[model samples]
Target: MVGRSVTAVCLAAAVSGAAAWAGTQTQLPRAKALAFGGRPVAAQRHRQRQPSARPGVGVSMNVHEHHHDSGERYYGPASKPILDAVKSPADMKRLNLSELKQLANELRWETLEAVSKTGGHLGSSLGVIELTVALHYVYAAPEDRIVWDVSHQVYPHKILTGRRHRMHTLRQSGGISGFAKRSESEYDCFGAGHSSTSISAALGMSVGK
Candidate 1:
């Protein structure tokens, strides 16, 4: 019963966030005008950069095209359906059930890929992709804290939040920590390196709230 109530709360929060995001998008024209003095930053940057006549300077290279012959196999549409659209939980809220399922698949694949490359908690992270997405979709994160027990399973959560771009930096020197740390992100409400403390930490946050 408690679990179901928590799920309900999360879903309500996700919907609210989605509605807010939609509204924000509608106001983008005005926001852009204010942000960039009526000219977009992208246009300004493009105009500012003139190609250098000097050899070996300002030379554009197509590094991604030839960096790996098998890059398409890893990053093609089949493996990254809903994942590419998701920049945060607000984006996840825009997805329907079918899209959410696709997102889960993409999350799992991305997690596997990152783990294979960086060597961290693969099995645990793979096992919780759907659960993490569902939770983030329902709850207002960084506000309604979702504490993980022995947070080796939190890679998917990190990716769903604002840290997907940083997945390649997992567990490296000066990179994201292997376990959840409050300092790492607002989404990481409670630090978890060991088991059996998540419930207590969540209770503490709940009571404090």
Candidate 2:
């Protein structure tokens, strides 16, 4: 909390990027929610900051070394056609509600196996699976910019748009980034890491026009 003459700044970090994707970030005023103590109006927002370069790979665990099951049916580059077939919001939109559940399932298993090997932000990314799918289903990528705050949750986003096969190479010294990288993806609108800042950046883009 940052306390000034009249107001206080509170910082919150939600692990759900899926919720962020749902276009459900609206909220009531803080003044109305909190009990007021004599003070001034505080200007508060999440400021994007450079991420602390966390070193060290995940401690290798061989909990299931005895039996390895690699029998997985995966779509190859053929998925590119399916991805290309999905262009606009109307195209990606789910005609059936069941697809959200299916997307969630796919994201979970993929995330677990990937992060199990790579060991990044496992919990947050797993939690937001539904939200990510919903957003992709609703918004047209490369055109409707989606800025991810605290970019960890973006792994699944990367996977769905066509990075599924790269799970084994995640976070390597010279591999796919653990966060958004312009070189890695065109889907990433603005790369960021911090508690929050997406809305502000989007506002700037809006004002740029």
Candidate 3:
């Protein structure tokens, strides 16, 4: 009877120990899965939680990287057929008012994008986009010699007058001048940074002409 009771107690203890070992084996895999799987699962959940229709409007992710390309990434209106066709003021003359309007919008956006990347006078460049387009449309540039007063406003002018390709090089070392340079292009009849100097230069050009 004593031997049988000892045997029964040993059997129960062994069964409990085996059960506990089996439970530990099952729990380890679950714990590892939770540890490893949680990150990607959470990332996927976050992505799914985001609104598909307006993905960028309110999201506080890194946007500057997406907004403009770095260093000759080719984000501009010059790629458009209309803008591409406009190699010079002569090309601009061929476009109708409607096309010119479209060109102005494209040019404005392009200038804005370029300036945003290259870091220059954005407000001044944007302000004169219409004027630049209209002037090129109406007058014969290089011959008529459209003189920009504070030549920072000449970004659109530069684009219109066969310098669209080199726009990325604005104000860089050994690149195109930010202000007008007579040697740079004939369209730039006078180069002046100051407002007062532009008038005198324009007057000199008018008198010389």
Candidate 4:
């Protein structure tokens, strides 16, 4: 399948990149380190400004926290999950192709688990699971500027970029945003809810540079 091939290529590339940067961690070519006046821009400004329901509490993907008459819902791993080791994109480089594939599976499960409760865009996010994993794993984010068309397609992106803990609170009052928000995370370079805006935004970011 085309999707399977793509994932394989991405994993292979990630392995190569990781090996290249093994001795001394070097920035990926596309990665532009977050720099403003030669200092790291505030990473969690949005969280600091607007706190979520359970700050610092990791979300459990295995089961539904809410009780329903139907039954308890279970999603990903019960213990020692691949996703548990991945708090950010950088954490993905160490995983082999098999592990990367497993991570993608877990990431998909996490996305479904979060969106099922919060009620946001799901199809688009699911569609790009492998792509998101590849992008984050292959390139450096916040600096690399991986813009998504119709920002709702970033749930998996959010999960990979240090927002997994707040995923359960998504789209709620005082919670993480449904669509991308620049203040929400450095990884979200451009924020747009509607379609066909990603090209323009990418152009502007490129031209500005």
Q: lDDT scores for all predictions?
A: 0.65, 0.55, 0.62, 0.66
Best by lDDT: 4
lDDT of candidate 4 over 1-209, digit per residue (tens): 11211111122233454344333222211111222112122333333455456879653322112323445434445653889999889999898877877777688778877887889888677666777777777777765777677677789889999999999999999999988899999888778775676656676766666
Candidate 1 clash figure, as a count? 3
Clashing pairs in 1: 10-138, 10-139, 11-138
Write one digit per residue (lDDT tens) for candidate 1, span 163-185.
88888899999889889888989
Poorest stretch of ten by lDDT in candidate 4: 1-10
Cα lDDT of model 2 by residue, 100-149, tens digit: 55445556566766786777887567656666667667566666666776
Q: Which sections of candidate 4 miss by over 4 Å? A: 1-74
TM-score of every candidate: 0.63, 0.57, 0.62, 0.65
Task: Give residue 208's error in model 4 in angstroms.
Answer: 0.7
lDDT of 1 at 16: 54
Clashing pairs in 4: none
Ranking according to lDDT, highest score first: 4, 1, 3, 2
lDDT of 2: 0.55
Q: What's the true lDDT of residue 108 in model 4?
A: 75
lDDT by residue (1-209, candidate 3, tens digit) is 01111111122223354344223211112222233224434554566577856646664432122112223232444456778788888988778766777777678767866676678887577656666676666566666666565677778888888888998999988888888788998777776674546545555656554
Clashes in predicted model 2: 2
Worst 10 contiguous positions by lDDT, candidate 2: 1-10
Question: Model 1: what TM-score?
Answer: 0.63
Q: How far in Å is the alpha carbon of 15 misplaced in model 3? A: 94
